[model samples]
Target: MTLLKLTGIVKTFPGVRALDGVDLEVEPGEVHCLLGQNGAGKSTLIKVLSGAHQPDEGTIEWAGSTVQFSKPTSALRAGLATIYQELDLVDDLTVAENVFLGHEPRQFGFSSRGITRRRTRELLARLGHAEIPAGREVGRLPAAGKQIVSMARALSHDARLIIMDEPSAVLAHDEVENLFRVIRDLTAAGVAVIYISHRLAEIREIGDRVTILKDGRTVAVNLPARTTPTDEVVRLMTGRSVEYVFPPRSAAAPEGTPLLRVSGLARAHEFSDVSFDVRAGEIVGLAGLVGAGRSEILETVYGARKAAAGTIEVDGKPLRRGSVKAAVAAGMGLAPEERKSQALLLGEPVYRNVSLASLHRFARLGFVQRGRERDAVGAVTRSLDLRPADPRRTMRTLSGGNQQKAVVARWLVGGSSEGGSLRLLLLDEPTRGVDIGARAELYALIRSLADQGVGVLLVSSEVPEVLGLADRVLVVREGRIVREAPASDLTEAQVLDLVMAGERAATAR
Candidate 1:
């Protein structure tokens, strides 16, 4: 059956047409993938379907009948559920309470807590996660655990169609495999799924059909997900023949002292005995599975987390442990993994966020020189090609890719003319939730920064990204460096094998 159909979906916002005549269709028991770059209208179309926003012009057919959803509740009641990239669960709520939040069972005018917990447990078991305690607070669970809870909540509605936006972004390899298993089970039961992700390989693995959107309009509809060439899909989404290619490494030898040196770094239970050095104009990458301490290592080096032992030296000067201020003072800039929470001030203006790291330069007598600050930020942001190109716009209004650019631009503003204020840049999963097109731009930008003689230390879950972008590759597993080699000496398969071998060995022990 044609479970859901959207035709000519036109949605507009103030000074922007978010979706311009978009179309989509989902069938029972099929995984329909929606592919688009950021700002390509995927989010707007999904919001329209979920009733978060009403389309200015469009036709929606649900179960062969024309229908309109005015609110999220109405859409939920109509058997449509959406799981946003940022989860909606309340941190303080229990798993059971979150699962049955809006529609808890009532007994004699009282909310039945027992019934909610029992039902939530059952749902979790059905979704292949019987271990998550129903009474535990949602905030206490890890990212993968939270995702499973979100899935249970979606199933709580008896939803016939579920929309998952970037569901695997926070999940590791094994967790993603588990998610795929759950998705397969959902589709086997005749439920429809509309999946969204930036990882093209995933679309081939789990998707049945694909619909490509570009610039607020549907470019191609109902293309075979697995058989469609990846390059063709990239062209459709980006309007250009773009390959996932990394820039050539600079042949010029790095001059001057090592920019960053970590001597026997240890973080108690996180990572231990980790040591590495990055030279000026060099890019060093850490490749490992999620939870293998890649992010932890970066955080420890950045002084966000105190190292139990060992020292971090920048330009031959040791940094004070656990002091972000000290790290910043030593010319270190970290674009953390969680950009929204750790790096960006969402409610602040673009120029303010971009100028955050360099505020001292713009300050005089406890007053900021706004004009100079704006001009400096504007120059860097323009070079990054940040969208909207307006310094006064709120950071929350920008897309994921643009927000990331702003974070990088923050370090670029008002730095030394010789090497900028940043001598070392630490990037943790820099392309986590960004689209392919934007990823290309970021890759180029990172190379340009390295070319300017800034040493970069990167951590990425994707092995190919690490190998392609880094001059030297460090393979970390189970909180230890398993192998170290030049990026040219390793392939993706070799890195994956090393990582998996560690996993198997750990399991045996």
Candidate 2:
């Protein structure tokens, strides 16, 4: 029997028809993969299924019976659960508390803490993460740990079907393998999974069937996940074949004095003795697993974190340590990995967020010029092909890819200043939750920036991203750069070996 079915689903917001006549079917004990480009209605359809949004027109059948879930709690009560990309765990609460928050076991009208802790531990063990402490606060745990807690919470409810949105975006390779193992166990126990991700390779490995959505409608359904050709899949989602996504590297090698230089950079426990230089018109990439100090290095260089001992120089001039103002004054801009939290203003207008870095340019004495700010923001955003193309729209209304574009746009706006142009651009995980199509666009954009003589430094968990997009590849292992070579000289397998076992190999050599 079909575990869940949807026919002719339609959902609309004020000016957008998010979902239009979408259809889906899922069976028991199978991983149903959802594939689409960003803004292709995948999010809206999931919202409808999870009861966050009501479908304007559709028939949803749960276990062969028509049902309506007016709210998230209603859906959860009916054995449906959703684990979003942005985790919704409370920071101050313990793991046990977050797992059983709303539906705690009670004895004599009091919640049973003992039972909750025991259950949480059991769930953690089942998910192959026995090291995660049930008593530890959720916020203190790493991203992978928080993901496990969310899954434990879903399992606690005895959910028959679960939806995971980009669950592996934050996980390392070993963690992703552990997740697949847990999914196998769930499917063995007859739990259906609706897996959403932009990684086609993952779908081939874990999914049983596939569904493709385009422009708020289903383009293809019931395709074998393991056998679908890459070109066919890309065409269905993007209306064009994009096999060679990465832009070509520049023929002229970077030479002359370095644009940005770091020597003996160290942060107590995160990283140490990191020394590197990026020359004008160069793209340098740092590749490693999560928590490998790649992001910490970028933050330290950009003055977001204080360096215990080191010197940073832009154009041969020393930068003030631990001062964001000095870094900005030196024409350095960092698009952090966690853009929503560390970079963007979600509640403000798109124009405001774009102009945040260069607000002083639009200010005169005691007053400000709003028109010039909007116009400048508009020009940059339009050049980036920002969707909707409206500066007045709220930043939160745009898709993940669009939000990333806005973050990059802010730096471009600052570059227009008279004496302070962007010298070096630092990007950490530039395509974290973005779709494949958007990833291609960003790759081209980064290359274009470098072509314009702007030095670029990038950090990515994806080895291929570093190898394909960067001119130089720096392999980081255990908070140190274990290997440095031209990107053309490194292979994916070699980079992985360097990241996982580079220190041992280096010692032996």
Candidate 3:
């Protein structure tokens, strides 16, 4: 039986018709996968369903009766729950508090903290995560643990239908398996799931049916998820074949000295004896599972963290340890993983954010030359194909992809004003929260930067990303470099096996 149906859904924002004549149907106990490129109205449609936004024109039939959700609480009461890509848990609250937020059980008109903690523990156990302490702060948990807490919250509401937006985006291979198990249990209990993800491989594994949306409209509906051809799905979502092709590696060999060289790099208790060289026009990728020290290695090299022992050189000049200023002075740039908190000034205008690193060049008598700064920022933003093409807009208003572009554009414009050029670029999880179309563009941009003779050191959890974009690949496991090979010499499966084996060994020890 159809649990819910939406017809002729039309939702419009001030200047954009976000959802135009969209339609959807969901059956109980089925995983209905929603497939779309970024900006394809998936978000808008979900917002409309969750009562965050009301459709301008539509008919919603719920359990054989027409209904409208006036607010999020109304939708929750009607058994609809949404877990966004960025988990909506309150970091400062305890696990129990976050799980039962807004609907805490009461005893004699008083919030029963003891009962809440006990029930939270029960819910965690039900979700195979009993080890998570109910009283522990949500901020203390890792990404995977936070995911479990989010799921526990959905179950707390007794939701018959749950919407999961990119739920597995942050999970590792094993964590994804655990999530699939949870979804299977939920479906067996007659709950429906509206799943959204950009990973087609995941859809094949966990989805029962698919609905494709494009340019604010549903292009196809109720296709067999497992059997549908990937090419067909990509074409539907993007209106093109959209092959995941890496830009061709330059045929010529690098001829000059390495732009960046690290020897005996070690961050005590994090990584040890790590060594690598990225020459101009080369991309070196580090691939490993989360907590395997890939990001820590990058951070230590970028001078964000102190290295207990190591020698780092840029163009034959040694950089001072644990000093980002020294690293930048030596012609190095870093685009960190957590862009929002670490790299971007959210409330500042795009021009100011992009010009942050290069402000010294536009400064005279302790004052900024605003016009020169704007002109330089505009050139870099345009070169990166930043949308809206306006540098005056606040950084927070831009999408994830655009924010990342602005982060990269900062380095492009700043590039060591005291030196000849940007010798090396450190990128940590460059495409973490970006969409498929934007990923392709970012890949192209990274390659273009390499072509301009910028040495690139990249770390990504996705093995394919490392193999596709890097000229050389380093496999990190248990705070050590377990293997190193040319990108063409390694396969994704081989990399996974190596990483898993290292993890298993660490666990055994």
TM-score per candidate, in order?
0.96, 0.97, 0.94
What is the per-residue lDDT of model 2 for residues 408-463, given as tens digits with 9 covering 90 to 100? 88889866334488888999999988887888889999999999999999999988
**Count of backbone collisions within predicted model 3:** 0
Q: Model 3: what TM-score?
A: 0.94
The regions of model 2 sitting more than 4 angstroms off are 416-419, 502-504, 507-509
Candidate 3 off by > 4 Å: 417-420, 503-509
Could you tell me which residue pairs clash in candidate 2?
none
The alpha-carbon lDDT assigned to residue 462 of candidate 3 equals 78
What do the candidate models score in CA lDDT, each in turn? 0.90, 0.91, 0.88
Instruction: Count clashing residue pairs in model 2.
Output: 0
lDDT of 2: 0.91
Task: List pairs with backbone clashes in candidate 3.
Answer: none
